[model samples]
Structure formats: structure tokens, C-alpha cells
Target: MAGVVTGDDVRITRKVQQLGSSTLAVTLPAEWAREHEVEKGDSVVVQRDESSGSLLVVPDRTLVEDAETTVDASGLDADALGRAVVAQYVLGRRLVHVVDDGPIAPAHRDAVLDAERGLMGVGIVEETTEAMTLRCSIAADDFELPTLLGRLDRTETTMRDDALAAFLDGDAERARAVEQRHAQVDKLFYLLLRVLFATYRNPDLNRAVGVDTGFPLIGYRSVAQDVVLMADAATDLAALTGEPIPATAREHLTGLEDAIDDAADAARNAVVDPSYADVTRAREALDRARNRTDAANESLERERPEPLLRLQRAVCALSGDTRHVRDTLDVATRLTFRDGSGATPE
Candidate 1:
């Protein structure tokens, strides 16, 4: 059994005593047992983290029960109410009760509906005058983090491509479509956050989520955030494309776009497969993206084209903003460090 350590480095310890022949046992803390609703005959699950050599005990009962939270929609406005529901969802709450003492206002009800629509696997099952119930059907074992992250990667890739195509053709409709897909990235991001939080609480979920409990889990979160940031950059680029492009800037911008595509692709793929070759490719791709951006910046400076600042910023984001992906390459790099074979799913 692992010792429970709390604030100020205080550990709750128990003395071990002989129970029977070749058997020894430690007594559970009465308070902890009671708080967990652990009765004499109830089963408790003990999970061990191989990386940290720590054991966690949880009541089996809680695992099977859906976690529910009550959100008092009292003084909160529509936006705040929506955010509150999202917060509860991200915290791994499967059921959220949006309750008001009296009849729910139309604006507040609409906000709740919007929030549900934005979230993955979340739906409204019950609605009444005073309260509404939102249920999240996301099971811990249903989708793995790597799989979900890969989906996000691909979705953003398509979005970036569409945005670029829309920009080159001066198609506002396509650009608007790209902007709308950012919501898809957000849904994946929040769902990943929820799974990560759950796995941290119960290391047993690491296998279910197809990620290691330690750095890989944290690294997945980091990479997901980077993908979201890249989407923002891509969307910003799309919005700017409505104006006429200078011929000189166009060539450099196109080069930067290709460079971004290569770098982002390699990096995201490495995260999924995590081989030494893949990691190296990711690193080299990012380096090339940087060099491409620098060359474009120099060219723009020499030409002094119209909308120079905006063009320059756009050029920079292709490498500067999107290349934030490089920061997460360490995840794949480390995984490949032990063996070029990469981490196998538990």
C-alpha cells in the first residue's frame, strides 16, 4: 500500500500487523473508508502506477455510478451558465443538473442547449420548467487519446488546406467554413481534457485511453492545445485573405504554407507512431519551416509590398504560431528514446 501524503508533507501512516500465517495487513483509515462509502463487505479497487510506484484505492461503487453535479443557475448570465456546465463536464461529470429555483429563463435555456451542442457525447435527456439534465455518454474506454488527437490533427489539417485554398481563390464562403470547423477542434480538445483528468484520478484508465499515465498523458494535453492554437492561426489567415494579394507576397506565402503543412504533418504523425525516424523527421520538418519563414520575411522586407505588415505576420504564423507544434515533439522523442519501436498500448 502507498502512503497517503497531504499538504505540508504530512503522511497518514498505519502500522502493519500479522494477520495469519505468512500474511500481514494495514488497517484502512476509518474516515477515508466512511467518506468513500466503503462498508465492511464492499469491494474497493486498488490500482498501481508502474511509473511512479504508487497505489490508489477507490471504492468500486463509485466507478460504476455516474458522476453527477448540480449547477445552481442563480445569478449567472447565459454565458456563465454555459461555461459552468462545460466546467462540470470537463471535470468528468457524466450528468449535470442545471437547476433554477423557479422556471428557467429562455436565454439561459438556450445557452444550455448551445453548450450541449458544442460538447461531444453530451445531450439533454430531461427538461422541465425548473431544471434540466444533461448527460454525457462518453465512456472512459470508448475512445483513446491518441486516436482522438490524431482525428484533431487531421481535421485541422483539412481546415488549413481549405483555408489556404479559399485564400488563393478569394472565396469568402470557404473561409467561413474553415472558421466554423474550429468548433470541431474545441469539442475534441474538451473531450480529451475530460479523459486525461479521469485517467489521472484512476491510472487504470491509462490502458483504456491508450496512453501512458505520466508524461504521455500530460504530453497529449500539450499537443491538443497546440493543435487548437494552430487552428486559431489558420482561421486568422483565412480571415485576412479577402484583400487582394501582392504577387511577390503570394509566392512567399505559398512557400510558407507548404512548409507548415509538412512540419505539422510530420509532428502530429510522430506523436501517434513515435519512432526515432519519425521524431527526427518532425524535428527536421520544423527546422525547414523555420528557415522557410526566415527566407520569406527577408524577401518581404526587400520588396516592401502593400499590406506588408499583415503579410509579414501571416508569413510568421505559418512557422511561428503553427510551429508551436515543435514544442510537443519531445513527447514522441522520449517515447522513441527507449526503443525505436515506440510505446505499445497497454
Candidate 2:
């Protein structure tokens, strides 16, 4: 006997039986059947899932209401209101209202506008003097975690590469562009957060989000944060473009940059599709990056009294920020042992 699928904390076990020479059937619970308005002659829709070898029965279409909440922004400041809006979005709220007893302050209104622009798939549907409504039109199946993670990886890689080029080439315009492009990565990160958090709250959405409920979901969250940290480090490198960069500093950092370029790409791939071979490749590249960063840092201490003084702080900050890429190796190692299991519902 196998347990039938239903809501949490309840299980209905059933045994398969023969109907006719070439047919099989299982009796549905009378209580469940009556609740769904299904009768003996009713034709319930049956969907067969090839991957899990499971059949889904739908007696009728049920309309699910969107989840919503109302936030009273009476005395909250701009920063407070902004945080509130983001909090609701991450909690899977589909509709949010920022209301006050009377007309909301100008600063609070601007804060809501900024929050809406920052979040993905969230827009203002209606606005009045006293209240503003934000509507999130995204679904669980809208974007898979793997695909979203890939997009983040690509964007961060491009930004880092451009920022590094601007740093080493002393290109001011390109540096500005790199800094500006950082926002896109943040947007992707937030969207990923929404999906991951929502999926966590509703384990049934595992298939819809394209990541399993337990370990795979946690790994994606960690990897996404690491990528964002790398982007921040890259932006730091960009900011140093017009700084008084010493020749020795640039020469020392070049090796580290090269190592990270390979290490980050390899590590991201391994996290997304983990295997022994990919994990080994990522580990090797990360080792190279670590060694290079250590050497780069040591060079500053061994230099003359003020040789790297002007560039020491920027170099240290950039190196430390980018080192977060090393954390992804742990995730890759753990996932490699998962044997590609739990990728789909059972």
C-alpha cells in the first residue's frame, strides 16, 4: 500500500486493485469525493506525470485567492516604510497596501515608489492621497530557481569583468557603467529571494520553483548571496579606477583577477549541476585564487614604507569581498553527493 497525496498531517493509504483485464483502479474516499462534488458517473481529469510516475486527479477547477496584507504607515519614516514593503514581498504577499490615517507624508510616498521599482514583478496598481497599493503579479512557476541563478551568475560575471577592466585600464566611463549595472544584480537577487522564501513556506511549490524543498533550496540561497558579494567586490574595484593606483598594486592584483574569473565561473556551474568532476575543477580554481590573493596581500607588507599605502585599503577590501566565492565550494561538495536526487516530486 502507498499513501495517497493530500494536505499536510494527513495520509490516506490505498492498495491498487484490478478493474478488468487491462485496467486498474483505486477507490476514492467518500468524504473526499463528496467534498469535491464528484459522483460515480463524474469524469475527473487525470494527469499523468512522467517523471514521478504519479497521477493527479482534478474534479473541478478551484480558484485560489491571492494572499494580501495591509501595512499601516502612519508614523513610519521613509526607510521604515521601504523595509516594510520589501518584507511583505519576501513573505509572498501578492497585494500590499501602504495606508495611513490621513494623507501619507511625501517622503513615505517616495519610499513606496522606490521600493516598487526595486522589487521584481511588483508595481503600483492604484494610488490615492491616503493609500497606495502594490500588486505582485508573479507566480510560483514564473521563474525557476536554476534559471534565475544562471541569470544572476552571467550578470555578475559580466559586471565583474567590466569593472576589472576599468580598474586596470583607468577607464572612468566604464567604471561608472559597472557601478550602475550593479542594480540589475540586486533585482535578480531579490527575485530569487522571493521565490526561495515562498517555496520554503509552501513545500508543495518545490516542482514549480524547480528546486527541491530541503538541501537544493538552501544551496541556491547560499550561492546567490555569494554571487552578490562578488558583484560588490567588483564594484569596489571599479571605484578604484581613478584612485592613485600604484604600479606594484596593479601588477600584484592581476594574477588574483585571472584566478577569480575562472574560479567563479567554474564554481557557479558546479553549484547548478554538481558532480565529482565539476567539484574537483572548482576546488582547483578556488585554490589558485586563494594562493594568489594571499600573495597579493603579502606584497603590500613587504613593500617599502609607503609603496602600496595609497592602494592598500582598496586592494584589501576588494580581495576580502571577492573571497566569498570560496564559500560556494562547500555547497558544491555537498550537492555532488545528492546524486541528482530530489530534483522532482515523488
**Candidate closest to the true structure, highest lDDT:** 1
| Model 1 lDDT on a 0 to 1 scale | 0.79
Off by over 4 Å in 1: 1-27, 34-62, 338-346
- Structure candidate 1, residue pairs in collision: none
Against the true structure, candidate 1 reaches a TM-score of 0.84
Model 2, span 130-229: residue lDDT tens: 9999999987669999899999999988887788777666789998998998888988898898888776555556677777766777788899999898
User: Which runs of model 2 end up more than 4 angstroms from their true locations?
Assistant: 1-66, 243-249, 303-307, 340-346
What local lDDT does model 2 show for residue 163?
A: 80
Backbone collision count in every prediction?
0, 0
lDDT per residue, candidate 1, 253-275, as tens digits?
77767767777777677777776
The residue pairs in collision within model 2 are none
